[model samples]
Target chain A: MSVSALSRPSFSRRALLILLSVLLIALVVGMEQLAPLFRALFPDQDPAMYERESFLNLTLAHLALVLVSSLISVSVGVAAGLFVTRPAGREFEPLVSTLAAIGQTFPPAAVLAIVVPVAGFGFIPTLVALVLYGLLPVVQNTVAGLGTVPSQTLEAARGNGMSAWQILWRIELPLAMRVIIAGVRVSVIINIGTATIGSTVGAKTLGTPIIAGLVGNNLPYVIQGAILVGLLAIVTDLAFERLERRFSFGESGAMA
Target chain B: MSASHNPTRDTASARLVANRVLVTLLCAGLLAAWLLPFATMSPNRLASGQTVGLSEALSAWQAIALLALSAVLAVAALRRPLPRELAHGVVLLASLGLLLITLYSLGDYAQRTLVEKSPSARVSQGSAFWVMAFCCALAAIDAFQRASSGWLLRLGYMLIAGGSVAMLFASGHFDDLSIMREYANIRDNFSDQFITHLVLVGSALGPALLIGVPLGLLAHRHVRLQGTLFSVLNFFQTIPSIALFALLVAPLSALGNAFPLLGEWGIKGIGAAPAIIALVMYALLPVVRNTYAGLKGVPPATVEAARGMGMTARQVLWRVEIPLALPVMLSGLRIVTVQAIGLTVVAALIGAGGLGAFIFQGLGQYAIDLVLLGAIPTIVLAVIADFTLQMLVVLSKPAGTRR
Candidate 1:
């Protein structure tokens, strides 16, 4: 029953996904063409579009930042999660889990702000902040997902003469993949939002226009930036939904 | 059975010989103290400071005493079987002592050297101090975890440590520090901003609970509604908080313009209204999801038993289901409250007066201390909210179900 449900992409969802993607692309590519509309809305503001950098360039930059940071966060987070769960490193589990929980209580903005004093400004600090903030969800989910794998299954694999490494690679990881992917999805979405704030520290992202707009009180510019960012988030979320469903085999029900 | 137990006992004894986590942390702290600068002494607030090593910051005897205390901590951790509680006690006390001594010395150094030289001279904590402080905190937390399973014990420790720090602040020991100077400068409005931040969180939370609980209850009653409701809420959650705040500007302003009364009622584009609305929207997913899950989690048998006892549907829900679900629902509330506290900081971008105003203001002026002025309080608030709600969740567990 679940297998068939996983295979098919429902029509409305598929259409909505494509439609959002198209809209995002159109806005990115043709933001300038909407200037008259923006001007109509905000007559007091001159040059109603955010013209310092094109929307396409900003969107690409935003995605690139999130991509690099998410990649690093996932690998490092997953490694730490795996390490603490193993017999040789099991003693560190309490500390690692505690740190992950406490670290997340910090707001991402404050994390970014604090990093500035030590790492200085620009891309590296932004990257460091992103990875730091993004690490928590992935580590937590990886640990949680791996823990859900039954001990009996591990013993069964051992009975079949599989090495510890083989059991982890072939059985444990596959079983935990869905939860791990869900974590990655959350990390990516958070990074997308956080990357916008990266613009404040001189790492250019879609937030540039919005920040500039807020500072300058340019309503049109704010709207344009907000529209693109909102679309990107929705589109990315939909993509993850599809990916999560694909990995949902064997699980009784989908996790929200 | 004796033969099988022998190996397990041997391993347990081996484990007692060394706590590798604490040993590693102590070593790292010591290394950071030895290798990096302990503090920076700047002539004035704007100019960058020269780094001062631990040897420079404190006299040789004081530095040695500090290092000796750290070594004692490491040794105590290694001798884990010296009455397990005593070992943990030593670790905890040593770490706390190290922290207090380091800060006190730094403050003493700042008072005697920097402030005497120039009234405006600033002493900023350096990388080494931060690293040492972090290590001490983690070590203390680890020791506390090992020391007891009771929340009350942990709470006692927290209160002692927190009270000591508060007393230190009251005594003006850290007034020479740059961050403290920033605080002294903003002391007047600081409380106001802090109150504003709390108000913002409360405002958002009140509406969220009011709306989200019913939505969740509705979703629970109708399986079909659950799917659609969750999907819509999830969609709202996906939108970045910043973007959502900005996005609301257009329609909100238009609404205010159309109805002048809303503008008069403080429903403008770039203020508390949009910020609160976005926060409530972001909060709904956790609130609604948890409520629905909590209600659904009530065992059918329990509900049936309630009905069999001559209870009506409403009575069964209020008496049986809601009580059973309280913990889960409170956990969700915990998430919402913590998240709102953090998001409210970002709402400062939209001219909502809060601690984030200080943060952004400091960012604009390139003042790290000013940024800390805002960021520190924000973190403390979030942590407090998280801890308190976690306790509430634990307490809310139906008495029979609680561990």
Candidate 2:
């Protein structure tokens, strides 16, 4: 909302950060070249690390998994929430709430354990678990958002001859947009973190290095993998925060 | 679209409709249980199991009894002007009974089937049994919500139900099942892992509170610092638990090398040290956020009044701010304790020696029972921690203060 913040930074300044990050990532992916540096540090452990797949590929794969699962979770969670809030599906509110609560309370690791047998290993089971893990926030936010929509506003919409669907879309949803976005933010961020566990099931992600390091007692691999993952999480979170702020400000601007 | 919507009637009718749907779900879930396999019979633990449906495993009379009970619950759920308390009580009792009966009957069936068989044979409950258990839990929670009861009372009910099952379990009623067999095999190790899990959580909490409270107070005092502090903590939160664990190893190991005595004291890379460090890092956000929020929530007018009375800042903080903020702060502790309990299981992968050792071992062997031996207790621990901490938060609230 700050005018100074809205006045975007100069292109060169923005590009500097972007380029610096890119160069850093390049250095990491080509980290095998830095074996001497690693050897000087780790000394005892294997300095020449062999990550079969490139970090770029792993990062992309990890992000893709997060994206697909987050999308599914948001869609299903929001739809389920909307359905239960409707008169016909209202009875299902507690049932749906309980199901989501159980899904969340059950650790993602445990979910992986239970799901692996029926669904088999790799992406499907991991996706299933992540989606389930991600559902609670979206559903909770949707319910809270819809539940708090002022009755007077709904009545006004009805008085203006809007249909139920129209009121929900044009009035209720727009009003609840910020809350819904908050839910999606939470869900997606959670999926990003939880997705790291998918490496145990052999869905190659940034966790490959970390798991490999953990098993081999190779701290260098672990540090490299963890830094990338941690950075990704930070960058993604900041992006989401910026997106949320933009939406909030845009809505305020429209209102003004 | 009706303008003349009578809120009370609408809500009551909605409740009736919801009740009907829940009963339908219960009945359908029961039918699924009947149609699907109730347990699997494997020639050995490592062998692919054959499905044993309910009818194949249980007698016709047992099936009839279950069906009859299901019908009773369905009928009870549908009655007009539902007796909320009575219905809830019935639902609770019936669920507890059903779960016990199911477990006992399965144990009995396994014993009958395998008494003369090879020692390697394994009998495990199938997906149907799990689904039925889930449905029972769902229904009981729904009923519990409908019931107007205090936290202590609800907890007492849970204890009674849980304790009864534990008693039955201790009586060797479920020993024939593969899960219990696995538990029996590792009972001593199980206790040690449980203690280790508790210690990990307890140790993490001490440091978390020590650092988190001061950090929270600092952030609270300086508005500019709060944003950067929380963003850093939030960034820490978004890093996956395992990643955080992995990250801590290198630095911790270096520190250990620099200080021989610290290594002697178990401050190393691979074991509980890194695990506890990661947990403490993960815990700081909630504890800090909650502390800050709690302090921020104190009525400015009250603080003003205290200052007007010539109280020093520290005096106001200790005498006024703390008592007012204690409940919220405790709630934050509740969140972290529950979270830390669950996260500690992951710590076992690094030889931290918690329930996760069983879980990972089970995963390696593809033994679901062994996994359950660990996973179930972990869940139970988290739930108990959450419930107990929640009660503490409630109790700590000043008398007569509205929650």
DockQ of all candidate complexes = 0.56, 0.44
> Residue A65 deviation, candidate 1, in Å?
0.8
Residue B34, candidate 2: C-alpha displacement in angstroms:
2.5
Among all windows of ten consecutive residues in candidate 2 chain A, which has the lowest summed lDDT? A247-256
- Give per-residue CA lDDT, model 2, range A1-256, as digits (tens): 5655434432333454466467557755776677788778777876545467777788889989999999998999899889888866775787777666555656667666667666766889889878888888899888887887899998899989989889999988877777778788888877777778778776788888888888877788887777788777766665566555555625433111
When only the first chain is scored, the TM-scores of the models are 0.94, 0.83
lDDT of 1 at B100: 82
Candidate 2: CAPRI quality band: acceptable
lDDT of 2 by residue, B181-252 (tens): 888899999999999999999999999999999998998898767655876787778888888888888888
Q: Pick the candidate with the highest TM-score.
A: 1
lDDT of 2 at A177: 71
